[model samples]
Target: MQVGIFQTQEAAADYAAAHIIDVVGGATDPVLGVATGSTPLKLYERLRAAHAAGTFTLAGKKAIALDEYVGIADDHPERYRNVLRTELVGEDKTGLTDELLFTPDSSAPDPQAAAARYDEQIRALGGATIQILGIGSDGHIAFNEPGGSLVSRTHVDVLTAQTRTDNARFFDGDLAKVPTESISQGLGTIMEAKEIILLAFGEGKARAVKELVEGAVSAKWPATVLQMHPKVTVLVDEAAASQLELADFYTERWNARH
Candidate 1:
């Protein structure tokens, strides 16, 4: 595990994008595990810019969303699928073609079977070459909320109140409209990624980032599972690194690498 503390969110995003570009350049049929939410918005924007500038190409790369709401239509604006379509897969965005993008069927007649199929698809694609993540304010990863099983696989997850309330912003401040359940890749599944990058910004994420970086590897802070992964990189702005006791050490490490 490596921690990088950048002066600004844009700087962190740039670092992440550059790293991703390098990984994609060397991998064969890379499949990216992508996360949604505001924390990763800058990274996606940077990736788009890199693609537009000819600094990198998204062609031939595949991607899978980390989770999807169980009860939402695939076309719903707030649905994870549509969100990825608009933000990461659109022709004007990352240029990830529809056929190469995989997401769970939120409205499937048999969601469990669909989840299992999605897991199989991931395995068949050679697992994710890189997994992008955003830690929740409460330290959750994907929809694996606090107290979630550490070894679980793809399955239905009941959204915690905090998660639902946090996601309410995407639903126009209507927490009631947010789906109560979601299908998410499990911790064990995410651990299959060859590389993992977790992005965090703002003071709002300080505690979670601190706990993830400094706390014990416990299920209470689901993101802490990254501590056990062989190749996990954590990038955070100064605000998000505020609560880390080893903030200076991380900064020194990043500076040395640059």
Candidate 2:
């Protein structure tokens, strides 16, 4: 794992975006595993800027969403699929057609069956070439909340109270409107990605960032599972990296590399 503690969130996004552009440009057929929420908004913006500048194009690349809310209308503005479409793709965005963005079917009659088919689709694409992730304040990644099986696959998982509260802002700050469940990619599935880029910012994420970078690998902190992956880049601002005991070491290494 490479931990990059940047002075600001924008700097971190710049680094992450450059790495993503390189990965996508180098791959013959790149499949991006993307995340939703506020933390990744800047990164997506950088990617769009890069594309507009002709630095790299995402025209034919495939993008697989990490999770989607269950029990929400397909047209819900806060739905993961709709969020990705507005933020990353479409005629006015990154130019990737709607057909290229694959998301779990949360509206299906059988959500479990939809999840299974989503997993198969990922496998058929030979897994994600690079996955962009954002850690929840509770250390959950892609809605694989704490205490769940670390090796589980695509499946429906209940969202914790903390998660729902955190996501309430997306639902107009109405906690009751937030979906209580979601179809999320399991740690086992995320681990299959050839590379991973995790972004966390703000003081709220400090403890989780510390656990993910310096604590033991355990299901209790689902983000910690990434510690076992061979190629993982953790990018954070000082506030988010505040709890990391080895912050100086990570900073020293990153500085020396540059």
Clashes within 3 Å, all models in order: 0, 0
Which residue pairs of candidate 2 clash?
Answer: none
RMSD of every candidate to native, in Å, equals 1.1, 0.8
| Whole-model alpha-carbon lDDT for candidate 1 | 0.89
State in Å the error of residue 114, model 1.
Answer: 1.4
- Candidate 1, residue 51: Cα displacement in angstroms equals 1.5
Q: Give the TM-score of candidate 2.
A: 0.98
lDDT of 1 at 204: 89
Q: For each candidate, what TM-score against the reference?
A: 0.97, 0.98
Compared with the true structure, what per-residue lDDT tens digits does model 2 show for residues 1-258? 999999999999999999999999999989988999999999999988987888877798899999999878989998899999999886456777789999999898898998899988888998899999999998999999999999989999999999999999988899989999899998899999999999999999999999999989998899999998999999999999999998999999988887
Model 1 alpha-carbon miss at residue 96, Å = 1.1
The runs of at least 3 residues in candidate 2 whose Cα sits more than 4 Å from the true structure, single-residue gaps closed, are none
Relative to the true structure, candidate 1 has a C-alpha RMSD (angstroms) of 1.1
